[model samples]
Target: MCSFKLRPSKLSRYFCENLKIMQFKNTAEFAKKLDAQDKLASYKDEFIFPVINEKEVIYFTGNSLGLQPKRSQKYVNEIMNDWGGLAVEGHFKAEKPWWDYHERLAAPLAKVVGAKPEEVTVMNTLTVNLHLLMVSFYRPSAKRFKIICEEKAFPSDQYMLASQVRFHGFNPEEAIVEVKKRDGENHWHLEDILKTIEEVGDELALVLIGGVNYYNGQVFDIRTITEAGQKQGAFVGWDLAHAAGNIKLQLHNWGVDFAAWCSYKYMNSGPGNASGIFVNEKYLDRKDIPRFEGWWGTKKETRFLMEPEFEPMPNAEAWQISNAPVLSMAPYLASLSLFDEVNMDLLIEKSKLLTAYLEFVLHEIDVELGETTIFEIITPKDRGCQLSVFLHGQGKALFDYLMKNGVITDWREPNVIRLAPTPFYNSFEEMYRFGQILKQGILEN
Candidate 1:
């Protein structure tokens, strides 16, 4: 379980010495060799990838919803047994008390998002947590009354921002600043984003951008963006729904004021699992911050006293609006335990190599077909497991064909196919096969 920690010089040397010999190829034999050399290869068996027609489906939709962990059932059964035996006493007396269950998740989740244990907490769904954090962070005064966000942010985020502005009696159109890519381009350039931040410097009350652009799969420079927004005297937050568990983050180190992400994506938690939130430790004791709080957020010592005066916990847990749903959280624990063992440093390195292989295979398809007619990868070089491929034409038919052939990729509106090769469960062999299928698909279409 030791992580591969190498300095830049040594890492380069290691790559040249070890990885150069393992050159990526479009053949199945090369895929096998890569898989054989993969230290994380054994991890693929930990999850239950979907099977269809007596064959294992090429499940590449982890960016949408990750496959289930085998230990999830065991984790849930423990809670179920506690409910059946201890009943109400399970809150205090169970093996892992339901009352303090969420606390157990905080430390491991902190590692995932690169935050202090006191800065992160697992609680409500992503949108709910986003809105809750906004109630505290989106404090717009007379001069700073605008929010700068991405134009192509998730639909729920767009709706949430609009409603938040409207709730404050501000016109959504006037108070919300949306930054879009240049015409004819799918990815956002860093210079353009920095320019926009400068343009809205004075009026920007908040800057809430997706850590990774979901549609185009572009990873943003969080530290630089946060610094830029802060220089403009604006609170900086992140919607990490598409970035969490897939990419390495430093929410606290980067001075990200707050962030929220769903656990079901690359986290490998069950569907609709509890979301995690990070509130920087600098704001931990800011009693003036207006958060939507509840009993669960009160200090543990006096929480049972119910004295009517809310004494909030001196950590990110103070933002909790209600007691966590233990059932929904159990499976997350099972998955988090695995992350703790394997660690993000290793996972992130493996992810880069695996996705690079996918990209290589895709290019090979273009060459094999002797045409640029297949599809174009819109995802940038710096990305996580997911790659967004823009289909040339009649994408629905090709998508349907892929689905029927047991390739489970995600299709967005219009003509984008998102292929996510989860490092935890997906294999190099699958990437090679997908390239072959995609070439066949393009030719048939």
Candidate 2:
């Protein structure tokens, strides 16, 4: 048995408690034994995997794009069939009416992100939804025009924030305050984030950050940061592209003003699927809020009445500018069905142990290599399943070797590889196999 120091969380506690009594072995038989005992072992069959060299590739890129659910085709086919048979009547005649198809995902997505059903809605893509959320939340005045965010956030987020400040007639360099990581540190410290928010003080109008960083896979303290920013009289929101289905969130309980996430990642929807947004209940049905209106966002009673006055929906759907993309949302709904079967609590529990096992296997491979470890896992313990490993004394040749040998991983510029072993489809056996493949790749290179 080994003592693992993980970030403080309910899931981490569970992982540590189990680790204290169980020994981790770096053998194929041990991996199979663990998989045999896995409750979600059958879930691997639910997703479609790419095969290379006559074997299913070990996928470790769920942080970027999740594997497609096998049922997704059925969902998409239903939409296609409805569109073909009913034509214009599909809006109301179809089994799942096209008009309110997006509504099907609201409840399940709310559970995954820890929000009220009314607080969540499926709509535009990730960046688009963030921009829309900023329209209502990022209110800037002469005295309160500054925004605080993590340094080197996902490039799309950086662009959105910059464009937002500029749209409000403020220079980005002066209005945007980025909380920088300490020298030689891979992750941001919570104290630094709160301190920056405090220092910005009255000038801070908005605090928008990624709940989980894309590069380092660090999970930010969303609740604490939201409270700190709001205490300073600033609106706080999150871009949950990497956090939504990967980590546990309590958006409503945390009192976050607004947030958005893409379903294509950990939610296991197809690539570039529709995004989901969360709006605090306090902000819902408010006539005072600034928003871009559309017919789809109006109240259902008057949506077809052709009224000149815009009557917004009483929930988060009020932020929607147009009709839902049912084709894109079909797969998302399909993926949510799987989530409905396995709640976030169970998924998170499995994630903690699976990621810990992956970490253990990585270390085992490092020990087998030499006295000096050639890998440095940049992702901190305050993370979900993603482990961003920096390869020292190894280059793209190793990455290429892994790809050629049927390992699907995400490669970042310089020399880092992000591996996310999703709780649903990814198995403990794959983690052990990855470690062996990695060692062989290094040796061969």
Query: Who wins the TM-score comparison?
Result: 2
Candidate 2 segments exceeding 4 Å error? 1-20
lDDT of 2 by residue, 1-445 (tens): 2136433221222235443346677789988998998999999999999999999999999999999999999999998999999998999999999999988999999999999999999998999999888889998999999999999999999999999999999999999999999999999999999999999999999999999999999999999999999999999999999999999999999999999999999998898889999999999998899998898999988888899999989999999889889999999999999999999988887888899888888877877787787889999888999999999989999999999999999999899999999999999999889999999999999
Residue 229 in model 2: shift from native, Å?
Answer: 0.2
Q: Residue pairs in steric clash, candidate 2?
A: none
lDDT of 1 by residue, 1-445 (tens): 1112222120111132124433456789878888998889998889897776677899988888999999999999999999999999999999999999999998898999999999999998999999999999998887789998988789999999999999988999899888888898888888888899999879999999999888888889889999999999999999998898988899888989999999999898888889999999989966788988899998989988987988889999999978879999999999999999889978877787777778777766766676455667888765777899887765699999898888999999789999988889888999989888887887798
Cα deviation at 168, candidate 1, in Å, is: 0.5
Q: Which portions of model 1 miss their true places by more than 4 Å?
A: 1-22
Query: What lDDT is reached at residue 43 by model 2?
Result: 96
lDDT of 2: 0.91
For this target, which candidate reaches the highest lDDT against the unseen true structure?
A: 2
Candidate 1 residue-wise lDDT at 99: 94
